[model samples]
Target: MVKEIERKLPVVHVCTIVPISQTVGANRIVPAIAIPHPLGDPTKTEEEEKVIRRRLVEKALRALQTEITEQTVFTD
Candidate 1:
């Protein structure tokens, strides 16, 4: 589980719904695209989708490196 892993290592919860993540005690959260396509957008070209996914991944990476005392949502 995310909370279990987070006890030792930082975990970034990338989900379409932020409220649910918070309810489950996700300290590091990243707002995703959608439920069906959390990391990709079907409306965009393949290359564009890749770029969007890359940015999302980068945000998660940043969240991992950040130090927080309370629940934090990283949005950029």
Candidate 2:
């Protein structure tokens, strides 16, 4: 599946609910929020979680605009 994607698309970004280790088949990918949640943990207030999610999304957006050759770890 990963090979097919890499063969078909020049650029691809992925978001996962599971940890990175689970995607052992994919060749190249960008990190993303967890799968089902797509946001931070549930310990914070709604407002606080919103802010964190926004920040994480912004970082993902930035990753799309670059042409680097290595995996970038987008900090939340």
Candidate 3:
């Protein structure tokens, strides 16, 4: 579903805690939040979660400026 969109348009995915190896099966991968919550887990401490979310979001922003044509996974 996501890969299809990237193929047709310019798209970047946010993969926070997603392992690079696991993303292989998918058509494309982006650096986002953790697996359970791609935007940050609500169960964690607010300070901790906010810090992690900020870092991941930063990476996603960086990826958006690149000219990648393959499955690119950003790291934090």
**Which sections of candidate 2 miss by over 4 Å?**
1-38
* Candidate 3 backbone collisions, by pair: 13-30, 14-31, 14-32, 15-30, 15-31, 15-32, 16-32
RMSD of each: 0.6, 3.9, 3.6
Clashes of each: 0, 2, 7
Q: Determine which window of 10 residues in candidate 3 has minimal summed lDDT.
A: 20-29
C-alpha TM-score for every candidate: 0.96, 0.54, 0.59
Best by TM-score: 1
Candidate lDDT (C-alpha), each: 0.95, 0.57, 0.63
Better of 1 and 2 by lDDT: 1
Runs of candidate 3 with Cα error greater than 4 angstroms are: 16-28, 31-33
Q: After superposition, how far is residue 49 of candidate 2 from its true place, in Å?
A: 0.1
Question: Candidate 2's residue-wise lDDT over 1-76, tens digit each?
Answer: 5447656764434556324523554433446556666667577898998997787667656655656565444443
Say which prediction, candidate 2 or candidate 3, comes out ahead on lDDT: 3
The full ranking of all candidates by TM-score, starting with the best, is 1, 3, 2
